[model samples]
Target: MKILAIASAGGHWVQLLRLKPAFEGHELIFVSTKTSFKETVKGHKFYSIPDASRWNKLKLIYSLICVFKIVFRSKPNIIITTGAAPGLMGIIAGKVIGAKTIWIDSIANVENLSMSGQIATSIADKSYTQWPDLSNSKVTFNGNVLS
Candidate 1:
């Protein structure tokens, strides 16, 4: 199976990395915002997109363009994201191209999903929450990435 792991920099990337051991038998690709992450997430292809927030329209457009190029070129079988914003876009694109998607809500979202995770939930095939009871049945209880 071909797996594409997508996330933003910092904590999101850290969370996605925990799934690394699970994908060892399959091909892997990783997408994130930090160029520096190339060193940390080893043994997979990597892509970087411009980071954007709710207010950055130009950056958001540019990020979407980059996403199209990357997704088309890679054509992954599955996409897993620990997100901020761009990860939501990736989930939709992945779905359009017939990729199964998993959205892992940030551990930082103690009471609710991050804005990105909330959006991704609409399209993701499976959603996981680190906090068990806080998770709705729509969101699976996946335990902690760190542990």
Candidate 2:
């Protein structure tokens, strides 16, 4: 299976990378911020797209375009993300192309999910929560990614 792993840089990217062991037999493609994550992920099929904050509309639009480009080109079987904004873009693009989507809520979101995770809860094929007791039916208790 072709797996497209999407996330922001820093902790989100680190968490996503931990899943690499689960896809040992499959081809993997990674997408994250080009500038902040250049050195973080090495020896992988990587693509750098713009990273956006909540107020950054221009960056979001550009990232969406890039997401479409990546999604159409990769045609991944599954799209998995641990994110803030880019994950939402990947989910939309992946859904348009009929790919399965998974959203792993960030460990940093201990009591509540981030904005991206909240949006993803409505669209993701499945959602996971690191905090086992968060009590959101949309998510399963996946434990922390670090553990």
Top-scoring candidate (lDDT):
2
lDDT for each candidate structure: 0.84, 0.87
List, residue by residue over 1-147, the lDDT tens digit for candidate 2.
999999887899899988888888888889998655656656668899988876888878988999899999999999999886888899989999999999998898987887888888899999988897864778888677888
Clashing pairs in 2: none
Candidate 2 regions with alpha-carbon error over 4 angstroms: 35-43
TM, every model: 0.94, 0.93
Give the Cα error of residue 127 in candidate 2, in Å: 0.3
User: Which regions in candidate 1 have their CA more than 4 angstroms from the true location?
Assistant: none
- Can you write out model 1's per-residue Cα lDDT over 60-130, one digit (the tens) per residue? 88897787678878999998888877788789889889999989998888887777777777789998888
Candidate 2, position 116, lDDT: 85
